[model samples]
Target chain A: MKMKLRNFIILIIAVTFVSGGLFAQKKLTGLEIMKKVYNRPSPKEMEAKLTMTLISSSGSKRVRTIKQFIKDFGKVEKKIMFFLAPADVRNTSFMNWSYDDPNKDDDQWIYLPALKKVKRISSDSKGDYFMGSDFTYDDLGDRNPEEDNHKILRMEKVNGLDCYVIESTPKDEDYMYSKTITWVVKDRWYGVKKDFYDEDGEYLKTLTLKKAENIKGYWIIVTVEMFNKQKNHKTIMHLSDIKIDTGIPSRMFTERMMKRGL
Target chain B: MKKRFFTLIISLILIIWFGFADGLQITGYVRNYDGVLLNDDMDFSIVQNTLDLNFSMQTSKVGFKVNPYIYQYSDKTTVFDVREAYLDLFFNSFDLRIGKQQIIWGKADGVFITDIISPKDLTEFLLRDFEEIRMGVTAVKFDYYIGDNTFELVWVPVFSATKFPEQGSIWAVTPQFPIQPQFDFSRKDIKPSIKNSEIFAKYSVFSSAIDFEIMGGYTWDADPVIHTLKQIDPFTHQLLSLTAIPEHHRLTVAGGSFSTTLGPVVIRGEGAYYWGKYFQSEDPMLKEGVVEKDYLNYLLGADFTIKGIKFSTQFIQQYILDYDNFIVNNEVNNLMTFLARKDLLSGDTLHLELFSYFGLTDEDGLIRPKISYDITDGVNILLGANIFFGDKGMFGRFNKNDMVYVKIKYSF
Candidate 1:
């Protein structure tokens, strides 16, 4: 009995040391984690080639390719996308200027190759799906941390990485999604998975990060998939040939460049 | 041995052509379009097969594009059209384009308020696509860019007039003239000369607050006016055969357009004022039976989205200043347009759209409803209907032309 008790005490001590000293994690609020994600560092300039594949519920597939350029000017972030594949949309170009000021809405423009016209479009379509994809325009953009009320639901694991499971409710009651649950990877400063709920509080869609890479000391998302639970449709995006800090010219984001395809 | 030699020659030519074509980008579409009259036992009104092709090559400082289209009718008659063929030259702060090109302007939908750069083709009475209805002009266009602003100037060395329907065609309006009218062709054509050239200039600016454009043009009217010379018997007060003379006149115009967004709604406005305009007069007291006056055309529009559906509405007006009772055109003409679109089904492959134009002045309008389905990557099928309603106005004239159409298209 004495030997067994002594052995049990030593084992208990070892476990206590392991849990308290070696593997301890700093407790943080959900808002803090989301703030970290919102303030994550990004490249001043980036160029990427992306291929998007959309799959229907009946297992039909459609693919499109794009050559995209991005630049950050402290106060504004400008992006230009040129369609490079699919004959119908080939040479079609789109431009967007997203301002850092929360009060200022984004500006978008599209150039139709057939008409040779550049038209300004409303930016209020953030909640609308993009190019028939499961991902909404808001899903592809940045959201301020203050726009949501976040609470840490639990600590979990996602994609084999430790994550902070957080539930975020939008400040605007009439927003597209009633709430979104995100699995934020610990210390990586990025969300690996998210779940969206409709207004009735039923699950609507889910987004999962499939792959990522550490490029030039920067974490970059390589592939992602968005699945609509209600519609049984999904879209996958694979990003390739990512060049960071390439000093992209500001002139590349103009209406003239939208009409002049590369 | 001769056959072998010819095959080898053909293979060598193809190899050379493909080698040169590596730098060229080719895109085109093949479409089958059918239109049926609803009331004529669903009889086929028109059937057309189309092959539209576009080829382009671009470099850092130079580029060019060639667009050609062919339309074949049910009668085995084919019409070949060169839509646009242009060469582009790029500079540090400016670009120049020379050739047959189409320039689009303004923000109005289905209405031409300030978008008068290119003449239109009324052969089909606006039933054709806008791209097909607009005729390209051979001109030199220069665009200078400064930050978010652009200054454009276009010079047309040769005159290009609107394509009107031929006589005795189904689209022609049969008139009940007092006497059999004889036509004179002496002034029917505007000869190509520097003196007869047209010039247009525009300045556009894009800002966070709004997008706006200011423009001015000096050109000939695309439509001709008929000047009737009265003829009567000396002894008997009886009318004689009338000779109609159609002539184009100089027109001076100034216009501007603006677009802005307020929260979830977008607002657009466009207007143009003409200094010289000729109106047909039916009053016997007026000399020449025509009056020259100033004209105004304007449009106001708004677009919004609700429940994933996009909605757009517009109000347009055309005013003839100092209007006389004998003028054929109404002093104040009002028009309204509405468009709505939605996407449905998995991956949004199914689409629905409704567009309508309300001629408030004439109480005539056209309503178009369409359904589109994307079967595959580059294949699309569309089914649509055009309903015209009115008593005796523009659309009323086509009350019998209510049609149902289907279009199948393949792009590659």
Candidate 2:
């Protein structure tokens, strides 16, 4: 009876060590790591104050303040933003609805405080920069993984942390970006830095994440910087007073809420 | 005394606004605008200074906003106006706003087809900014929001008429008639009463691929109708003078607008059918020298961006049903507007834009080309020119007022 018990204990230890070694030695493909990054757990709602600063190579700076809210339903995600500073643009608001269906187009609208008019805008102007910022409208949205071909290039250390270097090339030849290379953190499942190339295969821009924190059980990036190589301009986004899962009412995403701002 | 009293009231409001310790927001701008006519004389066309202020406060259940401005012309005369002062009450699924406010509706740009709730200020011949062109009205507005849909109702208990340029002003446009007319101003004013009030309603929906709104209004005509009375000499039976009596009339209007996108292009449309609108006629047999006709006004526009340049074009038409030669206006009036803009330089500190209006029916046009640079945060420098062409039409009548202007604005 004693011999049988010892053998059973030895078998159990062998299985655990073998499994742990297998998991540690396993290599993940670029697509799988990217999928994990895209599908990371997110809060159902978010509210925050955003400050966008645009800096030119000549050392000139322009700053804008905004109050933003975002909510995610099952099939659609809605976001609303109101300009809170720069007296000229005060009370101006914007709303967008993104659909999960690949065939559906997003809906967008902008309210001009000066004209007191709400204007519906097209989503296809993704290549155009937003409000003269270095970041294009496309950069502000999520890209579907199916549209790109991803390959794991190499593993490297970025900012004293181990990262997976992956390059994704768009399937469509006419896409604004030729290819994008990203440095995703080893286990945290988020991109720390990304490099973009233009259609001409020349370096166009870089987006660097400056800060990230665990808020309400979700890892959220609070600050990021996008630099345009062609214009030598950069836009830094800083988030403050962020609250998540605050039970933001679904009605808050409507135009009425935009006009009747907080 | 009136100007001083106005200033004193504004000062008091400012002082009271500053007393609040929390959540009281105050902002505005100070601007200097100067213009020079392009004629050989090169005389000054306009010299004005403006101070605009906005005060707002908000709590969880209620909020309020007050906007007042002052304009000082070159003659050292001052004019004070309150653009909007409103109180808001918020609820779970709805909201209520009361007091003087500006309400805008429609999908058209630079046109007022379904946007008729606020009377227009034509004092500057439509060259002023749209915010300055639309005069606010005292009203109660209710907005109920559903999932992706909204219902809005507006009630105005008083009447406000369009403001036209005074006689002898540079923007005053005198219609050239067969004979000089003596205007009878007896019935031109619309008395403020419940019977003369206006009501408007709209239903709007925003979806994954399209946005649209349908609206209807029971209101007074934005502009007055002229009834001509021919004066004749007794002996020769010859026409001596024409007397025009301008009067306001009630009308019903229904309109809707929609906007959609196809790839990179945005298409927009707006239309309104006005019922029982009076028009001028030359028929001497008619007692009032006018006819009642229903008209339709619509606008279609498209906007696209390519290679960092944005382009927009709109086609507008006014069609009077039951065409007649006696009517002064053509059976169909056409107008087109075009705009192209480019933002250049690092951080888009420089901007260039060209906008123009072409009157197809009259072959007249007006073009404005402007360039602006951001000198620093909250400060801007702008230089532009307004050029008009053609002999006579809506826009051509102001050809002599073509001018170059400079505006420097600093906001806080």
The candidate 1 chain A region of ten consecutive residues with least summed lDDT is A1-10
lDDT agreement with native, every candidate: 0.82, 0.83
> How would you class the docking of model 2?
medium
Clash pairs detected, candidate 1: none
Candidate 2, RMSD to the unseen true structure: 8.1
How far in Å is the alpha carbon of B368 misplaced in model 1? 0.6
Winner by DockQ: 1
lDDT by residue (B1-412, candidate 2, tens digit) is 9999999999998886666547888888999999999999998888989998988888878888899999899964688999999999988778899999999999888888999999999987888878889999999999888887989999999878899988878898776578889989998888888888999999999876678999999999989888888878999988899888989889899999998888768999999999998988888788878899999999999988878788999999999999789988788989999999998877677889999999999888899999999888778889999999878778887879899999999988
lDDT of 2 by residue, A1-262 (tens): 0011001001001111223244356788888877766655556677888888999898778888888888878677888889987666778999888777778777788888787767777777778776677777777776776779999999999989888999999999999999999998776666888999999999999998887766666556778899998878899988889887889988778777777677
In angstroms, the error of model 1 at A195 is 1.4
Instruction: Tell me the spans in candidate 2 whose CA falls farther than 4 Å from its real position.
Output: A1-24, B1-20
Task: Name the candidate that leads on TM-score.
Answer: 1
